[model samples]
Target: MSSVKKVLEIQRETIPYLYEFKDSKLTPFSSSIEEYKGQKQAYVVYSFNKPETEQGSGSRLLYTRIYPNESAVRTTGDFNTELGEKKENFTLNEIKWSVYEINGTPNIHLKGEKDGIVYEIVTQEVSLREVKELLATFISN
Candidate 1:
């Protein structure tokens, strides 16, 4: 029973597109509900580490964010040139996602709206293939 699970349970009905990793190797680091201009948003961070023998043996972080309603979602660009290059754009299961390569490192940023709730996901040192695999596990409930 972690804070992430608790938040997910409480927000299960509120967030139509909420997702969590099913892999045991990935564990939630922290989760919380915060307010932005009177609107509440929830976010969870998960951390994973590969074995030292593996090529990418180090700590990696993945982030998930839920905007409970249309107003809470950021409508404008973040103006983050630091995100590096935008590789491509595609839609998956109604979620429009943008793939970006940050400093030649593997990463992803996915944001979309479903059932009026806006959902976003960001990954650090995580490959696009891996992110898609995780998304495939999500049950729309």
Candidate 2:
């Protein structure tokens, strides 16, 4: 189970250095991605400067409720591939778009159904060193 010790809101100017992010593994991200947000918990997302990119466009921000001892859930719509585009293996289906997990418990669905759909992905425990590499991958000028 995951816990949100505190809900710390970080302004854009105060965004943590990409090098400072620790924990959580860096999943294979698209090269078109413009920016990414690495939160303490909650959810992760990226936004695009222009419209979007199929390779690695949009912003990636990680978000989670900073509740103490309470499990938090993140939901994505997968609409228009705002968060990401369809992979070579995966197709866009109601079931494929949803992200549900147990950390939220009873009825917490990551990538909630409706706004788009929900695809529950098990977040692998990440090491600080590994995070550094992820930060490097998401870099764009």
Candidate 3:
């Protein structure tokens, strides 16, 4: 009897507090702010996955954003929107401490400190169905 080989491969990259999944060449959205001379400090975190068919286009699979000291995750360009082209902001604070997904949509999870208080932020987006299927497979095995 002969046995077949099953292989699972995942590619990940990190660059200065940013993370990219799937294709390495895809651009990640990120930004930050610094305080000087007792001035107020601010920070921003964002990322998204480009569509497989379109490269360098603004069509994103999962979009996430976080402002300094925010307790909720803000998202734009959700999949559920008509035509998936609307750039509206949505917030997710139901779950804390983790970025989660349901049926392909993504919820970005983050943590930050402000005014001596630590809080968690979770942003949600409607991702492509294929992405959800891939996640399901990855998790099942």
- The number of the candidate with the highest TM-score is 1
- Higher-scoring candidate on TM-score, 2 or 3: 3
Residue 55 error for model 1, in Å?
19
lDDT of 3 at 9: 13
Measured on C-alpha atoms, candidate 3 has an lDDT of 0.31
lDDT of 2 by residue, 1-141 (tens): 111112113221232321112324332232111222433222333221223443442233332211112223333343212233322232232222234333422222233222221223322332223322443443211
Supply the global lDDT for candidate 1: 0.65
User: Which scores greater on TM-score, model 1 or model 3?
Assistant: 1
What tens-digit string does per-residue lDDT give for candidate 3 at 34-70? 3334332323222345566755434443332223342
Among all windows of 10 consecutive residues in model 3, the one with the lowest summed lDDT is: 2-11
Residue-level lDDT for 77 in candidate 1: 32
Kindly list the per-residue Cα lDDT of model 1 for residues 69-96, writing each as its tens digit: 5454444232122566777777676666
- TM-score of candidate 2 relative to the true fold: 0.19
Model 1 alpha-carbon drift over 4 Å, by segment: 49-58, 68-81, 103-105
Each candidate's root-mean-square deviation in Å? 4.8, 15.3, 13.2
| TM-score against native, each model | 0.67, 0.19, 0.26
CA RMSD (A), model 2? 15.3
- Which residue runs of candidate 3 sit more than 4 Å off their true CA positions? 1-27, 34-42, 52-141
